[model samples]
Target: MAGRLYLVPAWLSEDAPVESVLPTTVLERIRTLNDFVVEDAKSARRFLTACGHPGPMRDVAMKELNEHTAARDVPDLLEAVRAGRDVGLLSEAGVPAVADPGSLLVAAAHAEGIAVVPLSGPSSIVLALMASGLEGQRFRFLGYLPADASERTKAILELEKRSARERETQVFIETPYRNDALFASLLESCRPGTRIAIAVDLTGPEESVRMQAVEAWRRKPATIGKRPATFLLLA
Candidate 1:
């Protein structure tokens, strides 16, 4: 039997009543997934507990699919199929493999002839672009930025150049703690008129997407810093 792989969206807290899920419909669909593979084990368990679906959470049937294991253990996930289990790949929040730690497993599953299933749901990249008031038709999600400050700045310079030449929406993210630093770097590095969007705590009550000039951003107080967030840049 072909192993079934489900890509479930983690947009809101399981205990969250309603308002937290931007569009009510997104949460409606999430209720159906019976099993999940989380990027953070502790968080995943907390989510399950909030959803009123806590189970034995057997170790044999579950795993953490985060950066710690995505590269080295992706192939091992296929054994789940051999074991006759329909598995789900989840993340700490939002969509999996979209800057999350599920891409390796996705590639492995396809290579091994495992069925890939994606559930329609929220994507911070798309949501940020949509709300940014920027051109959404042509966009590229750059995922996360480099760890080193100088390297990250260099990457930003290159990407800004790419955006100018190609008329593309360049999107990327940074570690929660470095949000302020990245934001500052972008403001200082990019051109004054460069249009940028930052989506923070998307889909939750704290959700916000800021779109404005790089210079303009520096004038205003920083809106996000070291929080779960994503960013989008448009030329």
Candidate 2:
């Protein structure tokens, strides 16, 4: 029988209690898997330890896969699964394969006809959307914006336009350090009447979620600082 590919979720906040976000069943499933394809092995080990995994870290088989991982090499990460040994795919944080690189491995598993199982847990995107007070019925997650200033501004404007026309919510994230820059871009590029939502440090002690008009946001600017955040807009 072919083994399964368990898409395990990790903690969003390093300091949050494991049980708070991860259910007992998910933890138990995590403990059963000895082979894993992880975005970061060190963090994966730490997460396992925090989950009360009984086995020694050294005994676990880990394969690293991240932005640096080549596409051609992704299939190799599923070797253990092909050999009838269950493998887990873990992200550095949140659920695996949503906006994560683990999607490559998951796609490989599917191509090979392997069973892929997803365990329930915290997903910052989902959590943020639930709290954003935006239109949950029609929303699109754009992941990240372009890196260049002009391109990013263009992307923001285009997304805002889409939000306005479709009455759909546009969701995207930014690097923690660039949170302020993205916030500034949104204010500059969006119309004054556009509804904007900011969800910061989700599941962390500093968690904050707020939604308001672009004009109101400008009147009293939010100190996004260096915190990780998700941005949503509806015009």
Candidate 3:
């Protein structure tokens, strides 16, 4: 039989202890694997080390799959699994596949009849939604917004309109360095009644989750600096 493909999750914060976010069962599952497809080899090595893998670092086989990886090459990452050796798919942080390039490999695994198993772990997106206290029953995750100022403003307005019309929560993320710009655009473009929630440094020591109307936010504008954050909006 072809080997199973395990979707592994990594810690959200580099400084957080492994047991804090990952359960003992997840760590035990990781210890049994020797082959992995990762977004970043360096971070993947660190994550595996934290999990206390049984073998030496050099003995663990790893293949990289990131934004720069070609579409044609994604399928090749599964060659070890095809040969009956279990493989793990890991993201730079959080769970694999969602908002990650590892989705390409997961799709390929499905096409080849490999059994894909998702191990339990912290997901910043889900954690943010849980804390936002918004319309979790009906929501959508829109990945990322446009970087251009004008385009971003237009996108923010469109998201607000869609949220109002559908009564759904809109979720998205921003690059750490550009988080402030995105926050500014939201304050400027969204209607005063629209609700916005900003979740920063989730699962880390500096974690913060705040939600209020656009009008309230403007009254007390906050800076996200360079921390990783998630944005949620409702109207």
Candidate 4:
């Protein structure tokens, strides 16, 4: 019989306790696997250590699959699974394959006739939307916006327009260090009546989720320093 591919979620914050973000059953499932395809081997090691893997760190086999990984090389990462050895796919944070490079591996797994199992865990995107109090039923996740200032501003306006027309919520993220810039662009480009939600450090002690009209935000602006954050908008 072919082995199964488990999609494991990692903690949003290193400080978050494993028991708080992951179910006991998920942890037990993770402990049973020794081979994994990870975004970063070092971070994967740290996460497995936190999960209390029984074997030594050296014994766990991890294959790297990140932005730098070539598409053609993705198939090779599944060699262990093809050989009847179960493997885990882990993201740097949150659930694997959503807004993550691990999606490529998941696609490959499906094409190769492997059973893919998703383990329950925290996801920043979903958590942010749940707290945003926006239109959860009809929403779209727009991955990272353009790094260029003008392009990002234009994209923001377009998304806001779409949200209003379709009554859908628009969710997106930004590079941690450039969060402040994106926040500024939103305030400047979006109409005063439009609502914006900013969720930062989700699942961590410093967690914050705030939603208000653009005008209100301008009056009481926030600084989303260098931390992971999710942005949402509703027109």
Best by lDDT: 4
Q: CA lDDT of 46 in candidate 4? A: 93
User: Residue-wise lDDT of candidate 4 within 1-235, one digit each (tens)?
Assistant: 6789999999999988999999999999999999999999999999999999886989999999999999999989999999899999999999999998888999999999999999999999999999999999999998999999999989998999999999999999999999999999999999999999999999998999999999999998999999999999999
Q: In candidate 3, list every pair of residues with a backbone clash.
A: none
Q: Which stretches of candidate 1 lie over 4 Å from their true place?
A: 12-36, 58-60, 70-72, 221-223
Question: What is the alpha-carbon lDDT for the whole of candidate 3?
Answer: 0.94
Backbone clashes per model, in order? 2, 0, 0, 0
Ranking by lDDT: 4, 3, 2, 1
The per-model lDDT (C-alpha) reads: 0.73, 0.92, 0.94, 0.95
Off by over 4 Å in 2: none
**Each candidate's TM vs. the true structure?**
0.83, 0.97, 0.98, 0.98
Model 1 lDDT tens row, 1-235: 7658878666543434433443354344334445556688787766544444435545324577776773766788667665666777877876788877688888988888888888666677777788888777788887778988899889999999999898988988787898988888898889988988888876666777778888788788575865677788876
Higher lDDT: candidate 1 or 2? 2
lDDT by residue for model 2 over 1-235, one digit each (tens)?
7899999999999878999999999999999989999999999999999999887999999999999999999998988998999999999999999998889998899898999999999998899999999999999998999989999999998998888889899999999888999899999988999999999888989899999999999999888988778888888
Which 10 consecutive residues of model 1 have the lowest summed lDDT?
Answer: 13-22
Candidate 3 has its poorest 10 consecutive residues by lDDT at 46-55
What RMSD does each model have against the real structure?
3.1, 1.0, 0.8, 0.7
RMSD of 4: 0.7
After the best TM-score superposition of candidate 4, give how far the Cα of residue 229 lies from its true spot, in angstroms: 0.4
Q: How many clashes show up in model 4?
A: 0
